[model samples]
Target: MKKMPHLSFWQIWNVSFGFLGIQMGFALQSANVSRILSNLGADLHALPLFWIAAPLMGLIVQPIVGSASDRTWNRLGRRSPYILGGAIIAALAMFLMPNASIVVSIMPVLLFGLLMFALMDGSFNITMQPFRALVADMTPEEQRNVGYSTQSFLINAGAVLGSILPFLLTNSLGIANTAPEGQVPASVIWSFYIGGSALLLSVIWTVVKTKEYPPEEYAAYKGLDVKAEIDPQYKGFFGFFRLLKITPKTMIQLAVVQFFSWFALYIMWVYTTPAVSQHVWGCEIGDSASQAAQDAGDWIGILFAGYSLFAAIFSVFMSKIATKIGRKTVYSIALLIGGIAYCSTFLFEGGEMMHVNLLFTQVDVPSSAVLWMFPMIGVGIAWAAVLAMPYAILSESLPADKMGVFMGIFNFTIAGPQILSGLVAGSVLRFFFGGEAIYMLVVAGVSMFLGAISVIFVKPSKSN
Candidate 1:
């Protein structure tokens, strides 16, 4: 067998750069969706349920994109066409989701938000699966770690920009931080506008700058003809499902871990705004009218930004550490740290108890803003591992041509748990935990520890 040529760092970087923009849109969705729903008067208890559309979209779209992209080759290349198409759809969704409130009635606004949320997530999946396959297609086995870690760095860096935009817009850019009851804030509106534009531009950069290896050369590197009968041109309605018959055991094990990890993450994304607003900032649960609660929501964005910043700077180091101690060991330790960090949120007494305070003139500041940043370090390291380790482990055992479809299947684990969490999170919070958001974090912490244990069972690979 001929050895695949190793790509230079610059070659690796150009492909990965698109993730920066993709993550921007994603980070915005994760950090702000709940807040947007709240501002539009969705019940806090029903908020988790609203997120169902996003995951359901992923559950359905990914496999189709994977299978379609696997069979596709054109002037735009195998993945770039999907990448460009998704970015455009997602950017438009970004513009529309928050602006859902501008509609005349609350029902229309709510439906609009859900529709846009679904589109953005579905479009994101279209790009995400292809990008994973792209890395595996271009890189040799030994350098896969570097390829994925670089992508992780770009993901986090984009997240840092996306997550902090509301804070920066209100504080630094002099945009209105609080809106009248039933309206979205100007700060948030502008942030999405800028992020959407950035997202499209970044993806365009990748499409223009990078060229795919032609089919024959790519087949040699991947060690398979992508045109095989198994994946042959998007033939049937349920075509991608054929690959499921021969699904690898390693992927199944890793999927279980992904379930818990993403479940924990979904809880954080859905509840953190309520937790910080009601517990830390002492605002009422249904008080979209209150400026204090809105400010608290912006600060949560800052906290998310803090973690992504840590991840951006820390991902490369974490990958190196994984090499020294073994990827599984490093991943387990990172999750444990993240678990502890999630639990720690329960200990904070809120802004009043915090010893130091920072200023954001338009919004209320959390006294422990500095302290909030620390927990993210744990989450950051784990986030880094989450972004890199599973892909590294799975790629070794997967057939090169089938990578896209398998990657699509892997998302089922993430989507299933998210769907489950949406169904039960509100009820669990109301009946089991008395609606105290802190307890949700406690649940999240325990879930992460379980995820750590589950990931240890990921089938070992020679590359890992």
Candidate 2:
């Protein structure tokens, strides 16, 4: 068997560079979707139900894309074709998502927004799953951690820009941050436009710059018989289930950690705007059209950008830190810190003020709300690990030819918890917490703590 030759740093970068754009689109969605939905007349209690579209799309799309990409070999390459196709669809969806109000005469504003959301997220999953498999495909086992960490750094870099675009557009470019009832703010609408453009161009860069190994070479590198036929049992639609029956133990262990981590993340994405608005800015519940609520929404963007900035910085050190302390230890500590950070939002009174340095400009912001950045620092560290460590560990246990499908199957862990969270979060907010969105974050923190503990049970493959 021939050893897979090590790739240069630039080669690894090209393999994963599309992630920068994909995540930009994702960060834009995460930071602004709740605001958009609210502006389109979604009730506060129903926000979680609307968010179900994102994970449900991933649950359905990822496995199919993964399995199909496994068998697809074209002039564009095994994964690049899917990457390019998904980028086109996602960008189009982004352009249409915020304009739901413009087309309200054709369909209900909320329904149009929901359909676009589902399409955008489904395309994101299609692009993202391949990128994960591409890194594993291109890098040898020893370089897996570095490859995944580089991808994480890029993801956060794009997220930082995406998260801050609305705030910057409103405060620096003099765009309107508030709109009439049932319309998205002009700043947010423009941010989506810019983000969608970036998404297409970045994915094109990756598709043009990177090359996948041809079949005979790939089989040689993976130590497989070049002419051997794939197992008959692992074919077609039912094949995904057959593959699940023989799933790797490491994958099963990691699923528990993924569930809690993603559940917390879903809560954060869906509730953060309202949580900050009502809890820190003193807006009434369901006050999406008010000046205070709009300001709070913009501040939430800054808070999200702060966390992504910290996550990008932390990702640079993750490979080295995991090398010294082990991946499990690093994963556990990061999640523990994030859990503490999420719980800390309850300590602030809305009267404080702070000066934030962003993109070489200083902006004065509410002290109570800006103070949330302190907790974001912790969340950022966890975000870095969450993006890299589990995949680095799981990749070693997977068969090279099946990498795409297995990575897609792993999406179940991510999408399932999010689906469950979306189903229950609104009810939990209304009944258990008296419609106080801030407390939902505390529940997110508790979930992260559980994820931290679950990491201890994950046993890496002997090869690792």
Candidate 3:
């Protein structure tokens, strides 16, 4: 068996460069989707239901794309074709989602927005699963940590830009942050446009720059029979279930951690805008139309950006840190810090004001909200680990030929939790917490702490 050659840093970077754009689109969706839905007249309690589209789409799309990509070998390469196709559709969805109000006569604006959201998320899943397989396929075991961390860095870097774009547009470029009732804001609309453009262009760069190893060569590197077909038991509709039964012990252990981590993430993405608005900006609950609510929404973008920035910086050293301390330790510690960060929001009072410098301009924002940035540092640390460590660990245990399909199956841990979260989070917020979004974040914190503990049980491959 020929060992997979070590790729140069630039080669690894090019392999995962598309993730920057994919994450940019994702960050935009995360930071602004609730705001858009609120403006489109989605009730606060129903936001979770609407958000189910994202994880639902991921739950369905990823494994299918993963399975198909495993069998695919084309001129554009196994993963790159799906990556490019998904990018195109994702960009189109980005363009259409914020403009759903424009199609109100064709369908209800809120419904249109939700459909677009589903489409965008589906496309994102299509692109993302393949990218994960690509990294695992191209990199040798020794380089997997570096490959995934680089991907994490790019993902967070893109997230920073995507998360902050609306704030930048509103404060720096003077785009209107608030819009007429039932319409998305100009700032958000423009941010989606820019994000879509970035997504398409970045994916193109990866498709153009990176070359996949041919089947024979790839089989040689991974010590597989070049002419061998996929195992019969791993085929057809029930095949995924069969594959699940035989999944690696490491993958199964990691699933528990993924569930809690992604559950907390789903809560953060769905509730953060409203949580910050009511908790730290003094906006009335369900007041999406108010100036205060709009201001809070815009500020949430900055807060999301702050966390992503911290995550990006942290990811730069994640591989080295994981190397020294062990991956599970790093994963556990990061989640613990993130759990504390989420719980800390309760301490801030919304009255104080602070002037922040942005793009060489000063803007006044709630000082209490600024304090959120400190917690975001911890959130960022956890996020860096969340994006990199599990995959790094799992890739070592996976069969080389099944990498794409298994990666897709692993996403069940991610999507399933978010799906469960979406189903119950609204009810939890309303009944348990008296309609307070902030309390849901506390729930998220506890979930993260559980994830921290769960990571301790995962035994990595001996190579690690």
- Point to the candidate with the largest TM-score: 3
- Model 2, C-alpha of 255: deviation from truth (Å): 0.3
Clash list (residue pairs), candidate 1? none
Model 3, which residues run further than 4 Å from truth? 462-464
Which candidate comes out best when scored by lDDT? 3
* 296-412 per-residue lDDT for model 1 (tens digits): 888888889888988888787866877788778877888888899998887775554333333543443556544667788888877888888888878887877767778888889
Q: Mind giving the per-residue lDDT tens digits that candidate 3 earns over 1-464?
A: 99789999999999999999999999999999999999999999999999999989988999899999989999999999999999999999999999999998998999999999999999999999999999999999889889999999999999999998998888888999999999999999999999999999999999999999999999899888989988888899988899888788899899999999999999999999999999988888788999889889988888888899999999999999988988889999999999999988878758778788776457887889878888899889999999999999999888888888889999999999999999999999988988889998889999999999999899986321
Superposing all C-alpha atoms, what RMSD in Å does each candidate have to the true structure?
A: 2.4, 1.4, 1.3
Query: How do the residues 190-231 of candidate 2 rate in per-residue lDDT, one tens digit apiece?
Result: 999999999999999999999888888888888877778789
| Two-way lDDT contest, 1 vs 2, winner | 2
RMSD of 3: 1.3
How well does candidate 3 score on lDDT at residue 216? Answer: 91
Worst 10 residues of 2 by lDDT: 352-361
TM-score, predicted candidate 2 vs. hidden true structure: 0.98
Query: Compared to the true structure, candidate 1 yields what TM-score?
Result: 0.95
Error in Å for residue 49 of model 1: 0.5
Better of 1 and 3 by lDDT: 3
